[model samples]
Target: MSALLAASRASLRASKAPVMALRRSVHIENTVDNVLPFKAGKHNKGKVAVGVTAFFVTGLSLPLVAGLWQLYVPIAHARSK
Candidate 1:
């Protein structure tokens, strides 16, 4: 009966040590709900819109330019003959 009590105490201590270590190792932060609140900005919004428009326009125009060049090359070759 004494050995069983001692074993139970040892197991309890072993389980509690890990719980204490985990509690100490955890880091709690003061988090806020509005970390970055959205605000209207005409200048910045215009710049971002222009940048996105330019990006998509350049992306789409490159393929169109390439296709046009391909068509022009065949037409020019046929005209040269």
Candidate 2:
């Protein structure tokens, strides 16, 4: 058991050097030009708006729901004597 433990420990220590050597800093530019690069921004913008609207409507998270629910949900009668 000690021999197996020693071998595993030695293997783990040996593996660390290559992993450290492979580690390096990475830089990614975050810009609309770099990310989207759309030839027609106006059409693409409208498409994105439609997609986002569909997503929210499908998820039932539209902002007007809370206010509309008050108008739509049936009001309960008073139970107090």
Candidate 3:
């Protein structure tokens, strides 16, 4: 019978080994060590420039604020009188 032949073919096919998929792993590298301490102290200059700018800003603004407060006191006293 055709059913019996199909059963025998299915049984024969099951005796072969199962297939497995294989893959190669991807490689990665760290880049931080190579980039630090940049050329000719230019990177350090950027940091120093920021610090200098902050120092100048703070130094100049304090006197300006004190002068403003000094000017405000006279006007406030006049208004109160």
- Sliding window of 10 residues with minimal summed lDDT for model 1: 31-40
Give the alpha carbon lDDT tens digit for every residue of 1-81 in model 2. 999999999999888767667776855465654454333255577777887789878678655777677765555323331
Q: Report residue 15 deviation for candidate 3 (angstroms).
A: 99
Evaluate residue 23 in candidate 1 and report its C-alpha lDDT on the 0 to 100 scale. 64
The digit string of per-residue lDDT tens for model 1 on 52-73 reads: 7999999999999999999999
Off by over 4 Å in 3: 1-40
Arranged by TM-score with the best first, the candidates are 1, 3, 2
RMSD of each: 12.2, 7.6, 18.0
Per-candidate clashes come to 0, 0, 0
Collision pairs in model 2:
none
| Candidate number achieving the greatest TM-score relative to the actual structure | 1
Alpha carbon lDDT of each predicted model: 0.75, 0.68, 0.73
- Candidate 1's error at 15, in angstroms? 25
Q: Deviation in angstroms for 55 in model 3?
A: 0.7
